[model samples]
Target chain A: METNMLPFMRRLQGATCTWLVQIAIRENAENLPCYAPMNIIPVKMPITTPPPDTLRCIPEFVLENVVVLITIARRTVKLNMDDADVVNLLAPALTLVLTFMGDSSRTYNPHLRARLAECLEAMLPNNEDDSSSHNNISSFYREQIFKTHPHRFQLVPCLLDVFVGIEMTGQSVQFEQKFNYRRPMYVVMDFLWGFEEHREAFTSLAREAEANMEAVHPPIFLRFVNLLMNDAIFLLDEALGNMAQIRNLQNAQESAAWTNLSAQEREQNLTNLSHTGMLARFDNILGRDTIRTLVRLTAHAPFVFCHPTLVERIASMLNYFLLHLVGPNKKNFKVKDMKEYEFDPASTVLDICRMYVELGKNERFCAAVSDDGRSYSPKLFTLAESVLVRIRGGDLISSLRDVAARVSTIAEQRQRDEEILANAPEEFLDPIMSTLMLDPVILPSSRTTVDRTTIARHLLSDQSDPFNRSPLSMDQVKSNTELKEKIDAWIAEQRGKIAHTSTSSTS
Target chain B: MAAMSPSERRLQKELMSLMKEPPPGVTVDGDQASQNLTLWTVHMEGVPGTLYEGEKFVLQFKFTNKYPFDSPEVTFIGNNIPVHPHVYSNGHICLSILTDDWSPALSVQSVCLSIVSMLKTTAGQFVLC
Candidate 1:
């Protein structure tokens, strides 16, 4: 029962629960008749003003929850709660909320709704919110409560009814009324998802209520996504199941042959599929109309797909899928027709390039892809150029052109460096011009062969030359191209001498 | 312990530890009613003898599934703002621990202590200087 933790909990509950505990202990001091734990209830008292103890304990920030939990817990220390007891307490509790909900639409039903929230709040596994709660229901106690108790608590679905309001019954909730009722519903969802048993039902109810909530409410599914994304039980696949993109994706993914294919095979098939022909591979999974709808949504309201920071994620995922139809490091993903795809890779790159532009609404995202100035293949450059031409984002277009131009220029420089290397002398064999410290200033600067690596090491502590002991920086060194030509000629002469030696030895 | 992901397990341990022996002037609202450990709302009280004493602030922590591996997004929320050099008016803290100085060994408890000490140091300087 963790009786040692009791004092800490009592301290946490502070004055309010302490006052209740003091009264209950004082009244039952000599030991009253002990009842079976499960059947016990709070001592009935008039629903009147303040008890002297409660009057003294009330804090400025009201936490009415502690008083209610202690009221219930005072009767029985370890509450052996069952489904019936939960339903009995909470159903009546909800009714009180609904009745109060009628009288006060302005302030809302704070008095009773807070009590209901408190009741649910008390049953949670111990934490800070429950710190103020005196009930201190053990984790084991809560587990048993759910294990023994079936779905008897009707309060959750009832709250949904109040939340959605006649939507289930085909009656519309008034626009203003819908806005006001969200808080209690939010509270109910928060409490319900805490229980392992209730999460599925909550998600299912969310699915059913989604259609009705479109106009008045932000998609309630997002709340669950926000909470459930980290949970192993709720995969990203399941979270996005209702979205057309995921639905179409799932249809394509669940294909028998597609599922059975090895990852290499799947990567091949998807990469090979023609842009319009790509619809054929997915057609086995989803209808043409569904794929069309999925594409349309992406083209239209792309923001609907954005879950907090998922814009980048979806963009990267599309790039990956376009590149290799399978997920990163994922295997056992198999595909058929391994040998047959010979169309332009640009088509596939361009497929995702559109969304890349769409996602480039974030200036930072645009700069990362567009301004890198790395040369792409002629195919990708054509695609990028055409994409830049289409997107019309001013910053992006100039950057894309700049990156393409820079990459080509870099490519030309690299080719020149290679040509210079083919003819270089033995003295210039080292790439960093490490063998000779030829000065860029063109004076009698370390004409003797000096390894630049040694100078670089010295420059780490002392940014000066080792030999002359003068001020020197790595930037000050230049390659001795004359020595490079001499080395190349020497290497050619050495090769000729080796050829002459081999022929003479054979004779 | 092995069953939970590193982030989940670490968060669980931190949650229990935080509840058991929380940092002074710091309390996390134990409303894990979402059962999602990735997000937390922490309540902090300005140390009693400080310039910002008697003030209450709430900090929202958003942790990804790759947390510890990835740093949590911690930002202050509420009407009250502590006028400190390291704290932005927009509630983005300029603390190194949140960015370049982050290490996986640092938990919610340590972060809370770091923030408390930062505030204390600032308060001490404000008074003495």
Candidate 2:
């Protein structure tokens, strides 16, 4: 078999020669031959190979030799062996291959040919230069390259690898000059669109890539991180939006559910739900970082458009984090050490109660005992009542009354001080008086001595002005008094009816 | 379904009122008459000084059958999403009070406010899992 390497070389030499001749006809065709012999042999041999695998393999060895020779030849001919050599050689080949593949009359598998072309494209200069050509390259990928061979878009990884190589070899300045115009966002957006188009596959790839982050080269790793971070934030926002919608639906449904329950049943149900055990599970899910991302994503969302459940989710996570922070076994711990604490409900409650005492937040103390009217545990109520009574002289009611009295005294003192100040010379009164008077004694006493019965009576009482010296106006006070009296009367009537019924049953 | 008890009715009305006149910078939507009114859909516009600025996000809320007394379940709704470190891609949130240390006194409004503030203060930072 007589092999006609001449015809092969002619064809390989054909395009470059034609392009050079066209330029030469205008300037100098003599320079064309100098560039021709170097590129012709390598490119021609690969094209003439009988097998596709042989053709594909040829570039590995042939490219380097051809590139070096082409570089030397270009310097000899044009006085510069710049990126123009690679661009001129690769671009024309790419254009030719792409155009050929796009032509429907060609019967060969365009997909395979496109894939092969991509492999070759990956070998081209990965410049760091921020140039118009770089932007054009990126846009080309986004518009033509990606569109033609969507599956082969993974070639981005290879392209990125080449860029990393260029960066590592100290050619970054030159590369940047060529490619710097391409924004990171463009590559990121391209990856995102590709990922979205193939979600499951991309997700797996992402996971795999993340798992292998340590093995990746520094520049490629950084690019991957940048891409991942951007995508993660974008997806988080989207996920959060969907979650908000679901939450709103859930809240509306829950309200309807609550309405369907009887008053007693509703109270019982709410009480049961408020139990520490149930809340713990709820917290576990919401307090996870995932919920934070969602909440943070839609925190300022408009109420009508925002998820109603966002608040609930945030509340759940906040409460959970706080519980972990201040709950029993959590004391003497820094925020960093919170996860070390064992989650014990009983201990957590005790810790909370102790904290309330330490902080002198009476409101919180009262809240712990009466979280929900129906679910107030007899044991917890007794314990709280005992603690209150022990501190407040064996009277829960009196303790509240004392707090009320103190509050009133403070208010009156504030009023008196203000009145005196208004009338007095500015220099006469001490400037320190306002601070002293306004400073609330957060810790009123070591403990309260209020019993359960007394606390209940105070709660139920109509005439008992527990928080003495009300803040309301006379008319408002009168109206509140009337309302309280009606409530008290109704309660008394109900009690009397229950007593009568019990007595009749006993008889 | 049986008629609602007065207390339940009051809760329903309160929920309705919240939906109709949600606090400023908050928006909510979902099925109105569904059996699980506890769940809802929400969209939030990004506030200034946050990483989420100029972005819209979604959330899902699933209230326990015991709601108000018990906090609802909230989760993010997307896959492989970008988020601040504070946010988990798994839809978990890291806010305080939703867990064991909850106070019944904290309302839905306050929770949302806290989240908004978190976004404002943290800006580019995120919660770590």
Residue B79 error, candidate 2, Å: 5.8
What TM-score do all the candidates reach, one by one? Answer: 0.24, 0.23
lDDT of each structure?
A: 0.45, 0.37
lDDT of 2 by residue, A345-442 (tens): 23333332332222222332222222222222223323443444444424333443443344334444434443333433322221212111111111
* Candidate 1 structure, TM-score to reference: 0.24
Candidate 1 regions off by >4 Å? A1-507, B1-3, B123-129
Chain B, candidate 2: TM? 0.75
Error of 1 at A393 (Å): 46
Write one digit per residue (lDDT tens) for candidate 2, span B1-129.
112322243245445666787765677763542444556665566775666667776666665544444555666665433375555778676776566434323455556666666657654455454
lDDT string, candidate 1, B1-129, tens digits: 012333564576577778778888888877661377888888999999977799998887889865664568888888876778778888887777787555443677777887877777753354321
Q: What is the C-alpha DockQ of each candidate?
A: 0.01, 0.02
Per-residue lDDT, model 2, residue A251, is: 51
